[model samples]
Target: MFNSLISYLDSIRERDPAPRSRWEILLYPGVWALFFHRIAHWLFGGRLFFLARLVNHMSRWITAIDIHPGATIGRNFFLDHGFTVIGETAHIGDNVTIYQCVTLGGTNPTNGVAGKRHPTLEDNVIIGSGAQIIGPITVGERARVGANAVVTDDVPEGATMIGLKARSTLVPAETWLREFIPYGTPCDEPCEPNSGDRAESLERQIAELRAEVEALKAERRGDQPHKMSGTNC
Candidate 1:
């Protein structure tokens, strides 16, 4: 446990592997989040509801993140950057990577009743920046949520989700890592051609057809001689 803490600290440090001054690095963002979350989760589970709420509020104040105390997060859960929001009922598995502006929230409109209303992200899942996995959905193990995606339904194991309303682009683990690890390459797979592209292609085809029509009209004009209005011989 100590080693894990140390490693976690190191990851948040400048040199990563090398540890900096204990005093300075102690308040690293990730470490602070982990510590706060650990305490908050513990208090939440122990039936200290008010205290848990307080801790969660404090965490939000300090970290700019709103993680519900009731949310169950497993070990080595890394919230990399930006404002991450986890709903009160979110269930995050071990080794989950949540990036900036990612939200694991519920979509249920009813306020009173509650039972598993939030998303359950399975182990080894990596959610990219600005991804929103909303409602009581099970994002399967090893699933990858692409940047800026809005997912409402359940994602299968090892699936990669992208686009608005979220469509799955299934691929092998090795391929996914190779394409997505470094980031900034659009989506991982060859997504269906965008409407804009299709529209542009159609426009080009229309232009070509119009040019052909004009040429045909010119050829027909050239093929016929204009009748002389009053000429005879």
Candidate 2:
């Protein structure tokens, strides 16, 4: 368990430029969420459904991230920000990175389907902030789902998915990494306007991510954004 914590912190430090120390990492909601999720997932696997749900709720309260206890997440899976939701049947593989306000959600009605209603993300998959990957999709290894993309289909290995329609472009993941693009693929959104402090920058990123999520939701519904008060990406 301690090794896992170290691995999580190391992964974050390697992939993100945010954390200044392990002490600061301790306060991150993602860290707490992943920690308790391990216990919750164990309880779920042991068939202790009631206890698992209780742990899930507690984790949600503490972390503000809703990861169903039944979801199977592999090593070094980092949920970069809070408000991320992973569905019960979702399976995330090793070294996956998911940013804020993303959802690995169900599309089919529970009453209508008997099996996996969520997505399976393979190793090294990076889901951008505010992306929604719904239904029983298989996102292959090293594939990237862009910010605000609504994916409902299988993604080929090393592909880059863009937009609500999820138009996929097959690019070798190795080549992309060789190019040194941050976050696996080139992002669509512009860089956040330089905020003075780390806290301010974090808050600004969250707001941008949230707005992108809302805009994507609106696009899928074929309507204008409901909240007209703020600038939306």
Candidate 3:
């Protein structure tokens, strides 16, 4: 058990550079939140719903991270910071890293059945700060959801998603091959309101359109002389 705890702390250290030692990592709110979640989840599985809820509330109050007792979390799942929410039916696989203010939310079903609504995150998935991954979608292994992204669909393996209503961008080979990307975003990629390549393409198009407009205006001005001469004739 001590070895497992050490392993988990080491995993966090690999992802985050701020922690000086394992003891500093242990002081993190995310670590405490996960610890409380384990106790809560065990009680919940034993059908002690009230006790589970009680523990969940305590964790939330202390860590400012709310993880439903019914949520299933795998080994070495890391919540990097606080103010994150994990829904009741959410399932997180091993080595999933979630940043601050991220939400693994569920969609309400009209059929009155509280079925599987929350998302399932596969192993090595990274969710950036303020990302909202809603519905029963499955985020595939090594998928990255960028900061402030709204993802309502299933993310393909090794895909990098960004922007509102998040669109998947082509992951560069260097970025894709890296073990851990800070904030689920590639520093090499331009962090813009739109996808990096797409935004550059749009700018090129706008420049070409402006040049064409200028050429058309010049041609119209030159034709004004001919029109005036023809009127005199």
Candidate 4:
């Protein structure tokens, strides 16, 4: 158990550079939040609803991070700087990193039944500060949600999402190859350039498809003339 705790702190150190030592990481509210959550979750699974909620409320009061006792979190989940809210049906995968003021929110049920309402975050995913991931969408593995982005749909694997509606930006090979990207954004260039390139690429592919269709039409026209001449003969 001691070794596992050390491993958990070491994982946080790899993601965050501000902490000088493992002891400093122990002071982090996120770590404490997780510790409280583990006990709460165990109680919740055992049908001890009141006790689970009690622990959850206490953890939120202390850490300023609101994670429901029913939320399923995997190993090495890091909530950097707190102020994050995770919903009841949220399922978090291993090594998922979420920044301050991020929300894993749920949508209102249309059928009046409470089911899986929150987002499912896959392994190695990073969510930036103030980013709102709403509804029951699945954020694919290694996906990055940029700061202040509002995402309502499923994020593709290895994609970087940005902007108000959260569109995917084309990440450079170098940026994609990196193990971790701070704030889930590329440092060197603005997202507009990548968006523009993606737009141009899509337009080029459409033009190529049109050209192929025109070539096929011309070939059919030529064959029809040859068939008519043979019939006349």
Name the top TM-score candidate.
3
What lDDT would each prediction earn against the true structure? 0.76, 0.82, 0.89, 0.90
lDDT at residue 218 of model 1 (Cα atoms): 96
Candidate 2, 44-68: lDDT as tens digits: 9999999999999999998899999
Better candidate by lDDT, 1 or 4: 4
* Regions of candidate 4 where Cα sits further than 4 Å from its true position: 166-233
> Clashing residue pairs in candidate 3, if any?
none
Candidate 3's error at 110, in angstroms?
1.0
Candidate 3: global Cα-lDDT?
0.89
Worst 10 residues of 1 by lDDT: 179-188
Candidate 3, 1-233: lDDT as tens digits: 99999999999999999989999999999999999999999999999999999999999999999999999999998898899999999999999999999988886654557889889999999999999988889999999999999887789999999998633555556645555442353323332435667889999999999999999999999999999999999
- Give the worst 10-residue stretch by lDDT in candidate 4: 181-190
lDDT of 1 by residue, 1-233 (tens): 87987665554453334445656667555557667888988998999999988988887888888888888888767777548888878899987788788888775434356688788999989899999888778999999999999887889999999998644444444544432221222222454547578799999999999999999999888756544433532
Q: Clashing pairs in model 2?
A: none
TM-scores, each model vs. reference: 0.65, 0.68, 0.75, 0.71
The positional error of residue 40 in candidate 2, measured at the CA in angstroms, is 1.1
Total clashing pairs for each candidate: 0, 0, 0, 0
Cα deviation of 229, candidate 3, in Å: 19
